[model samples]
Target: MMLGSSNAAVDHPTSNVTAFIRRANSIMRQLSSATLHKFVVKFPLLRGDADHLDRWVSLSAASRARRIVLDLCPEVEKFGDKNQMYSFPLHLFTGGSCVGGNPCVKSLYLGFVSLNLLPLAAGGSTTTSGFTNLKQLTLHKVSIVGDLQSLLPECAVLEWLSLTYCSLHCHDLIIRQPLEQLRYLRVLQCRLQKLQLQAPNLTEFEFTNQQVPLVLGDCINMSMASVELLLLSDDFDYICTKLPVALPHVRDRLTVGTAIRTEALVLTKAGAVFANLRHLILNVTIHGCPQASTGVLRLAYLLDLAPVLEELELHMYCVSAPGFPRNPRDLDAMATSPPARLHERLRIVHMTGFHGSRGQLELAHRILWSTAALDRLIMIIGPRIKVDYYFRNLTFADTGRLVARRYIQDQFPGTVITVL
Candidate 1:
């Protein structure tokens, strides 16, 4: 059962919201009392009364909805304003049995809601149980009050948990209890000083935030992980050196992203290795293009660490990068340097947001020249040079393709190259 505006992108008037609530009330009253497998109510611009919102949740609970999604569309303007968001009535689920007790909900997705769990009692312990059958939980743009750790013990069966753009009252988010069945965890754009989790069965983890101390205790089964850190200090070395140690068990796929002002790439610790790593993606944003060549060439050091890596993807973002230079001296010097040794195993290389700068071309040239096992090189032209930043002689893609055709096309006839 899905209600409210299907298109959350469009804003709705107050009268329409009020009418929607009235219509939803009528439908619920008219329907035959039965179980609901799924109940979804999405309204991006809804500011309904608390009583009306509580009624919807109560109806869903009474119907025994297995999956409930209450997405109030938390728009950009509602950010950081917890009072403006609706407070979810979690006490309705703190019961004993199914008939008059808790709803057997397996998945709960809440957006733009304030979730205030029960606080800790004396001696720092509390035993309020809710979401007992919840296997997956996703909270987006939500406000969390009290300690989050106090509420997780009740959710003993939670397998997947994702928190995006959520505000937690506490600075330290420490989940000491072992989530025995948790398989996946994702935390994005959440402000926290420290994060510590004990999920023994967790296989995949994704975290997006500024670099902070993280303790993923007993996560030996983690096979894939993506960590994107906003480089406030513009230090790329920290991402290269410290992250490998932090997430040591990442076996198959690994993605590391960072924004850097300085173009100097330094991998201090060469001992770190992704022994089982196959696919690697590097999402890098450079401040400028002139110094990009230096940092770009240094990526060879990182490639040396991933011995078994087969596929590599590069997403470069440099909007202010200048057009192709008349004389690319940096390209000539970089071309002579020996390629990253892992190129033999690297069969496919995909690049997105490519501006066809000298640095980008040089990297492409070096890879094509050295890698005999290379199968395909695909470069997707970016809109960086298309923007009227300055007077340009050619379009963004044209410049990149021209540079590639002039330098690389004739030399690398064996490999399949696609420039779009």
Candidate 2:
């Protein structure tokens, strides 16, 4: 039987109102920690100057929790300022009763809470002593302040770590462990200055930090990387110069996804080269409706950096809706795309962003004339409302193929054309 309450609103929550909720712990504390395999608690509308979440974590630790999820913030924090977030208890690390501390807690998740690693006593560094067996840890919207070193050191065998919208206002967040078994690491929408990731066995690393310089020490074994917010514009040359010095081996598969207003010209000047990069995908989003007379010309220039790139995909997007999204009835369908050669090793090319503007039409044809040995040319077309409503009323796909076949006939006419 499920034994937690989802009290929508605690009118007064006075001593008498919360007596039953507080007393429910007596039944829980009576059971050994080994008996509880999983525990979940969701408190709703904890009102005015009252928070009992700390006691819940203590009880979970003492009860030998294996998987624990505590969500203290389910609604907008408009009540008393003191009741916004719960402070996690730190005494669970120090073992007094049992020599084996929180040994069963392998999966731990805390949402809208505070994990202050600083010692509560007069003077002591917070220690992750009992968290030796922690394997999977996720902290979302968690304010991790003070000494954070204690919570990460004892996690020697941690495999996966994800921090989303977490505020770590410390000097620099470091991850260093000899032969650290960490394989996957992702950090998104974080406010940090410097990040140092030194995991030897790391395979997949995805980071989206706001212009934060990443100093990688032991990421020599990375295979797949999804990076954003690093090479934002041509003005910032830090990522270009620092990437090789930090991680000598660039991942074979690279995906550069960005929504900011950027031109392909700016990305080429970054002074970075992918000597071993195999496949590259560019997902760029423009700020406003692109002019019909001109194409962005941002993606074609990147081909020069990856000499051996075999497969390339371009997923273009526009911020605003285009006024006229169809080709004219009398418009000429056949025209020279352009100078004829951009990539020698390129075999396949796929484009998804199309509004049938003259600029995009010209760019599409240019790719056909340039690649001498290209195998496939795919252009995906859709209406502008695809952005506003998102997949509810998008039915302009057939137009994508019509534009590709009639106009921009490649110099190598054998290249297969696919429109979706």
Best by TM-score: 1
The residue ranges of model 1 lying beyond 4 angstroms of the native Cα positions read: 7-12, 30-33, 44-48, 74-81, 100-103, 122-125, 231-235, 289-292, 323-344, 352-356, 365-396, 405-420
Provide TM-scores for the models.
0.81, 0.75
lDDT of 2 at 227: 64
Among all windows of ten consecutive residues in candidate 1, which has the lowest summed lDDT?
380-389
Clashes (N, CA, C under 3 Å) per candidate: 0, 6
lDDT of 1: 0.71
Q: What does the lDDT read for residue 411 in candidate 1?
A: 51
Give the range of the ten consecutive residues with the poorest summed lDDT in model 2.
380-389
Tens-place lDDT digits, model 2, residues 1-420 = 124555545455455336645655665556534456677765532433234455556667766667787655554456424335666675564454233433667877777777777533333333446677778788877778874555766677888788877778675667443428778777877677777866778877777766667766657677777666634343223334455344445567776665544233344254556666677776665553444333255445556567677777766665544324354643465465556456676677767666554555656666656665655544343333322225532343345445555554333466666555
Score candidate 2 by lDDT.
0.59
Give the RMSD in angstroms, all C-alphas superposed, for model 2.
5.3
Q: What TM-score should be assigned to candidate 1? A: 0.81
Q: Give all candidates' CA lDDT scores.
A: 0.71, 0.59
